[model samples]
Target: MELKFKFAIASDLHIALPETVWDHPSRFHLVEFSIPALEVVLSHLAQLNLDFLLLPGDLTQHGEPDNHMWLTARLRQLPYPVYVIPGNHDVPTVESMDCFAPYYRQFGYKNPSRLYYDCEVLPGVHLIGLNSNQFDADDGQIGWIDRVQLDWLESVLSRVSKDKLVLVMVHHNILEHMPGQASNPLSKRYMLDNADRLCQLLHQANVKLVFTGHLHVQDIAYSDRFDLYDITTGSLVSYPHPYRVLTYERDRDAERLSIESYRVEAIPEQPNLQHFSREWMGDRSHLFMLNLLTKPPLNLPSAIASNLTPHLRYFWANIADGDAEFSFPNFPTNAKKYFEAFSDRPPADNNAILRL
Candidate 1:
């Protein structure tokens, strides 16, 4: 039998709370427009009759307790079921470790206390949420599921019905969206170190589709047997902030899965934002560069790849921060070896080029 379900997927919400609860610069994400922009998006979303909404991660400006509380309260009021997983920002960073409860509470995961678990959001639609964010020195870097979680995952997959479609949700991409696996530092710590092993598990079980957001760009990737679609939804505080609605269905023959992606642009609604509304809208064209770099998944420089993350962040901030006449240094050579997979171009999207 064929099953059809429509779900709305958006990520990197980066919700900022009221000013009294924030600290400037430290509260770097409190841009002049995210909250109001989000309000418009959520209100608009209510008009869509979606079965559910999947927010992969980064629901808060940071791991701030109040931010989590405010975001969670808002989520609870959404019109449909909402599922979430914690992003590095939503989870505790060095600055604060107490934000997970409210963050998790707002997300409504299988078990907030547990890093990973499954939720059957609808009949025959199993939503498996994985906590791919964690440190494991034994793996030589940050991010990896522990032996315990890995074993549990294997066992869980064994029980899923092959007839049902599986939609995996996580903050990091299990498959490469572009090339340099170590390119972007923001995602380095959340990528599953044992990603290949995880792939084996999902593939063997016929997990045809997976959704993810991190890197804040939009792109897609596929394996013959299965496809991994990555949508790095723009941050609420950043320019070109976006969201999308996805529909998954079986081909007429019911022999394969067909997924369609639709991009949703930002809509702002705030009085304070009127001053910088034009600025907040950002350059749609620069987003092309971001799409290019993140196409394969921030496979930035693999070595000091994480270090170079700061470099990319600074460049964007300079431009987004309204500084003109800025100069960006050449892509660091140390970072060259990491982007080998993306070094060569295949075919540009002829139809999607910006008319610069």
Candidate 2:
């Protein structure tokens, strides 16, 4: 049988109403435009005849009940079916965490009590949305998949037909998008705590495509070990504000997936959203760059770190924008090479066609 479908992903929506808006001086996300940016994307998508929309996670500015309510209500108004999972920001506290599955119950949670679910979105397409938000022993949230979910996943995959296409959607990344991402102190939080176990199950199940968010970058990472592809979308409230539309086709001959990414460049409040957001992130990049320089492998002296921070002002912004290539010819060899490694390695981040 031949199968084809089109879908859209708008991850890390971080939807915030005016009353729920909060501020932090050094924060990377711009929650102020979340609502408007989503509206723009939804308006555009409504015209696309999308099979469904997948919001991988971070559906609110915080785990505020109001924000969740607002997002669900808005999602209901859309013409297409929508599915969501929980991000760290979506369920920050243990108290609010239980409410996530219920609030968006209609989206994908057939069982409101459980945080994850598997459903057949189309005739031959299966979507498994996993909740990665978990509270640690100290009640602080972490990105992880519990053993119960793993066993449940194994059972579900065992029942699935090998000819059907399985698409996994989770909030935390299962593959590293950056160099040393899984082990890097600064980036490990965005990655699943037990990614190896999850990848094993995915590989065994022959699941090829995984959708994720939370790192807030436009990246498509492939794992040779698992033979899986992780397509992570950037935040709608962050720099360049990207979302994706994908087309998947399968026939007796072959299968292919095509990806196209779009950005919310301007809203009424910000005429030139891309330019403003890039500058907004650049203004806040100093401390982030300093941390990168002083942490782990680099561990540069404070004086040298400060000197290099200015030179890398737009480094992360370019990364978030995707398909970025970097060079710092005048900088020290180690620093230059280290920064360049973050560039889009291969296959491409923004747009591409892949054989499956």
Candidate 3:
């Protein structure tokens, strides 16, 4: 049997309405780059005749109700089905609002008011949706999969056959690139704090591939024991302006599951960070990501963050109109070393699929 579908993935669009809904000292402007950039990506995606659009998370800046409303209205106009989950910003950081449930109402399963939901994107392929954002009354927060969601997950997994293509979607990553994803002070402590528990759950069910955003850097993580891969894409508004498209198929006899990765190149004038470190080392705020070297796989810590921040902040202010890049040419070796270490997969003929 042959399974062929084309899908588009973009994250950290941080779409804003015409109004200035929220502000952070670090972000360029809510209404300026993100919304327009999303429009461009969506327009391009439509031309590709995509089967579906996987918006991993952060559909709006700060999870504003109006911004959420605006985005869905636009999504309704799209020609394909669009699936979404909430980024930390898509939920309220403040205790009162907790805006994520509303996003589920518009783009999630059965129109529920939870960030976690699932649906069938293809006849034999399943997309299990999840909501990873949760906070306590005392204002302490952790990215734990609550009991209700876990129950929901188990029930969904039970229905899948052993021979099926299952794509798990969520906003925060389970196995992040950096080691300190849970401990970093720079990221407002975003991540499924109990990601280990969630990983166990996925492993038990034989779920092998997960797609996530929110860290704003492109990297890959794999669980050797379970052979599960968690691939994170870079933000549209951040360095490299990266994105991805995946195509899955089985061998001629259908015993092996194979997948191919299409690394998104920046559109001629797309924006990329000379240093992903500079834009994210500190609390950049909701709608944008803190892609500091200190967080997760990089784990650069304070001294390095201090040193690199100077070089990074410049390009954020004035990236050129075309092919906006935030790379450090002066420090070539460091950059090369960074790329070699952080990538999810080594450079190869991407046209060939991996036998996962």
Candidate 4:
């Protein structure tokens, strides 16, 4: 039998009900619209007859008890199944994992005690959710799959047949969507610490597709070495406020996958939300851009960085709004080249259908 299905992914919902939102003077997330924006997306998704929905991570603003509670209740109301993983923000402390399972138990978990889960989302198709939040006091909030989970993943992959399609969902990125994600000091936070080990295992198992979030960029990174694709979605409450719809199909001789991305441009009260959000990001981009230049990989002096900040004001916002292309002709050649690389958008950056 041939298997085909459609699914949606909306990452980093950061759902903050009115009561849970905190005051932050320099906050980048417009989390107040978390609920409405999600509702808008869900309203559209609900009509699509999706086989399931995949919420990769950052399901709440700060993993507040109330926020988790709210998200669980809302998720229960959806018509289709939903699968989730805990992000660094979801479980602020390691102990919070204890309470995580009960909230999302109905979603798709054989054993709540183990944060990672695997289930057959469709015939000959599997969905695996792995928790990447490593909260060790010495290690801090790094992305890692501990030995126990790694072993569990190995056992699970070992049992699957060669014809089956394995779709892995993790909170952190396994591939470098940005420049120097693994080696760059500033970009390491967005990647899995021991990604090479996991990639080797997946490659051996013939796993092709992975859905991830947390960097809040609309990016798809493919590895020719492993023949793997890491598709990361943007935040629901940040600039571009995007989500994705993916359709997978298979037949006797061919397997095909299609990906299409969409953005939440407005809520009920804010019809021009896209315009407003971009401006908000631009207004606050000065310090962020300055830090980007002075940080590792660039390490420009404070004064030099400050002078160059204005020209690249919407640098990150553009990244968050994916398929970004950057070109600078006026600046010094080296500085211009260094900053422009961030906007590389190949043909497969946004949407495409591939034969597997």
By TM-score, the best candidate is: 2
State the lDDT of candidate 1 residue by residue for 1-356, as single tens digits. 56666677667877776662345433334444556767766776788778898888777776666777777788888878888877777664433433464356545643555767687888888888877666444533345666787788888888988777677877777765454444555445445567777777777886756667665544444554443333334355554355666555555564433333332244434444423433333322244334445545444434444444444443333322221233334555533444333322321211111110
- Tens-place lDDT per residue, model 2, 148-236, is 99999999999998988999999999999999988898999999999899999999889989999999999999988999999999999
TM-score of candidate 1 on Cα atoms, chains taken together: 0.70
- Arrange candidates by TM-score, descending: 2, 4, 3, 1
Off by over 4 Å in 3: 28-31, 93-106, 179-188, 253-352
Better of 3 and 4 by lDDT: 4
Model 4 misses residue 31 by how many Å? Answer: 0.8
Q: Give stretches of model 1 more than 4 Å off.
A: 20-32, 94-107, 136-141, 183-190, 224-232, 255-356
Q: Least accurate stretch of 10 residues (summed lDDT) in model 4? A: 343-352
Q: Which ten-residue region of model 3 has the weakest summed lDDT?
A: 316-325
Instruction: Tell me the alpha-carbon RMSD of every candidate.
Output: 8.1, 0.9, 6.3, 1.3
Better candidate by lDDT, 1 or 4? 4
lDDT of 4 by residue, 1-356 (tens): 58899999999999998988976877889899899999999999978979999999999988898999989989989889999998888887767878787788888665878799999988888888998888666746789899999999999999988888899999999999987778877778899999888999999999989999999889988889999888999998898899999999988888888999888988986798899888888988998888878887678889988999999878888888888888888867778988788876553656878767
219-292: candidate 3 lDDT, tens digit per residue? 56666766777766667665445566666665565433333333223333344433442344323422222255
